[model samples]
Target: MSFVRMGIVGIGNMGSAHAKYLIQNEVPEAQLTAVCDTNPEKREWIRSQSGDSVQFFDTPESLFESGSVDAVMIATPHYSHSELAIKAFRRGLHVLVEKPAGVYTKQVREMNEVAAQSGKVFGIMFNQRTNPLYQKLRDLISSGELGDLKRTIWIITNWYRPQSYYNSGGWRATWAGEGGGVLANQDPHQLDLWQWTTNMLPKRLRAFCGFGKYHDIEVEDDVTAYVEYENGATGLFVTSTGEAPGTNRFEISGDRGKVVIEDGKLTFWRLRISERQFNKEYNGGFGQPECWKCDVPVRGVETGHKGITENWVSAILHGTPLLAPGEEGIRGLQLSNAMHLSAWLDNWVEIPLDEELYLEKLNEKIEASTFVKKSQCAKILDVRGTF
Candidate 1:
């Protein structure tokens, strides 16, 4: 196959954007061939945009069986990602799922298992991975430019959303609908980048979450999590949709030096020698490691969702490597789930999280909940700047 015929399920905000670019041939080797949505208005809107060249289906199952597409992009709610991807993979099609792979890891694990057995290209829409700044950081850390990891701290709270933003969609912040707030919806990119750039997941985590603290919904709008990695490296992650004049700064301290990314720039502080080495050999009682501040150049602009879609198509057609393998999506979701679970239990949660326990707690939240959404109608707000 020289190109991929991509079908999109859930032609809502993100899904509609994918369709527009694909229809415009933004991806050289891909085309928008089919779409599925329960909303007749969305279907008609997409049909007007693409004409008869594209097929439309009211249900995902019909779309999967229509044979109009060689691959599928699942952009539905957080809870349906895994189920839809599993269905698409079973139908012998490549699958690309949106972030926060699923609400929990257990279902995502099952979806991943099926994708592995299907021998199909599976990708995720972790478009932030395409950012040159973050890419450079991951390269430096993995290439040992930052030496051994020591501590990592990220305060990425610039994801401020107003009450109307939550009101834009009925499923926006409701626990029974979208799963979790800030962490699940807004900060998946940062959480994924944190572990991906450092190449480590937490050994254990203790998270403090404020449910509905700033929003009129049931899920967390504020969070502070502290974690310890397997290498004895500790880390802190803080995020919220509640604060104004929010800050986004990611800092990493290594045995050799430190690196910081903030305000669209990355700064590196290089030490003459490892801090441990300097501390061990130095005779001065109050000496510090010699450090040099250098502004690192990050080449290329982030291609956003287009980059990921192109990569997924390339992986399907030309055997190219996927920038965001769908299997890895579970990692970020793990961090999100652990944070929520820790808050639910009011205690620490260990890594390799107890999935059964998490599910039980989640069910309790669903069953004992009295929170209600402001709107029950589905609305597709402009997702242009949201991500």
Candidate 2:
């Protein structure tokens, strides 16, 4: 039960949360060796909390070169994820990265290459995958109880961000900073969940995205993506930062029935089969032929970010399988980028999206744009469940 030496880069909102989870819990498996952030104040704040007298570095490379850490958790901006992950991996350190592993599919592929070469575990911080409700849904789908998942619609609009929420951080909502909105920040969880539960990637996508429709942000604050999966299944993914009192409702309809996750509960509606043998042969069918809403209770720890972090640390330190791997991250990022590209170009973008083209378009904007002034941003109105 030796503790794994750990270092964290970027002490922002998410980074700080990972640090807190590591130090304030029964993490007999990890020790915070150092913390790194360019901001002096953020570094100082982490020092005060952990009281590790741990060393702090000004740059990610410095943290890697210091030889003071065995593993590193990267909580930097979306654009920086690939660079930091590659650097840490090359240095022979295990890495954990925040959601949307890279801003684009190409960048993620490059990161995957580095991890493969390094032969180190690369974990993505898609914490929402650890939710029992999602876990059960994934299990049910994989178990084939649903009889071929046909369609999934995830209406997750409840990620409420106030104007000050975006204003509180300097590197938020800007293309040069976060790469995109809602999809990149608030909806990464839902996006990842969409792929994880269905276990299918869309073959093509058409999206309608509203940039600055509700907020004064430069990227999409609202998005609706129409997806056609390889198996001919369709999906509708919609989300927005403008909506308040929003609801998170996920429904998957298969040939047999439907699985709905809402209000923190999972309900399975089983379609009564005409073949009594099929019902009798199945483990969960109870030898009955009928359609009933089966309540699937959430199991395990309370659904929260901390639980995911604990599993992340444990999975790496011990031999526990990661809830979300870095490679799986690429699918979610591709989905997000596809939607953005489709909306931006006003055309259907194919899956395994044209990474080079997307990068080119993004670079053009990056080179031509000027940073938006926070003072110029319009006040975001608080609306309820309107995605």
Candidate 3:
């Protein structure tokens, strides 16, 4: 209740990064009181890095039962996110989970349910939501300034990862260890931002995924999904970790105009008149609506992960609304799961997907996995400019 005593439940790359910021007092109104990790070396490393003043626990249960933290940030693996978060909620502590929610929707749904009944602040680490460029884009679409949306396309392939990056962790690309590859790890932020900015969910989708295409991994490294929205709008989402000098471009077209974000710039092409109106009124057979190109100015800085953590702390203290509520985490996860299921089944899969079938298929992949990963060296990369 005072200074929002915080505990982090993973001392991996992201957890250590958060610890450094909280220890450095970057997140106002928050204090790193307890750190939890199953690895003794990681615990000792964090202790050495943080002056040995912070409490260390070998398990999340111990950390939760210690009464040392008013809130907990679950930064563990994809499989453990929901279990740890549910436990935090049971202990009457605020919960902030790292993205993708979990490997599947069933567990995430259960976590959301427990969170709803707990009456505690539940948030997700969708740090990209704090980016001013994405915030501006969401505002534009939500304000209806772009008219009725017609189509969306995002080719986000800038998530390039080398073999050593995956080799650094045994759980990097395996189906049983990390669930899926790029979709589960590298592209969750973009996937979350895709639906968050558009404020739309696909009705159904068909996907093509290339498993072990670019690495000695068991999960997907390349993906292309075609989606159909409930409002008849369609979308094409393409992503890969294999291509170098890749592109990250997102475009949304509407009846009034089109908005595009690419290469750190936002561009808007405003039609003098709505395309729908122009089409209905035009007498000429070949004429089109006149368009004027405008540069959309996004004012403000990109705050990244620190911004989200501070916002979560502020929300717990002040009754402020969360930028990315934990309940909504399932939305982006649903999209990712749907794509994976579609590719696995080789057919179009509907939203609110067949959870049982997906789980069965995932388990099969886990059982059939023949990948043998090298010993983990566990190098912590500087993730500041990666996003």
lDDT of candidate 2 over 253-312, digit per residue (tens): 987888898887899898877333465577883455568888977778653666655666
> How many pairs in model 3 have backbone atoms within 3 A of each other, for residues 3 or more apart or on separate chains, i.e. clashes?
0
User: Which sequence of candidate numbers ranks them by TM-score, best first?
Assistant: 1, 3, 2
The residue pairs found clashing in candidate 1 are none
Q: Candidate 3: minimum summed lDDT over ten consecutive residues — where?
A: 378-387
Model 3 C-alpha lDDT versus the unseen true structure: 0.88
lDDT of 3 at 345: 92
The TM-score, computed over Cα atoms with residue i paired to residue i, of candidate 1 is 0.95
User: Ten consecutive residues with minimal summed lDDT in candidate 2?
Assistant: 378-387
Residues 154-235, model 3: lDDT tens digits = 9999989999988986667987678798899988899899999999999999999999899888899999999999988999
lDDT of the structure predicted as candidate 2: 0.80
- Evaluate candidate 2 by giving its C-alpha RMSD to the native, one decimal: 7.0
In order, the Cα lDDT scores of the candidates are 0.88, 0.80, 0.88
In model 2, pairs of residues that clash are none
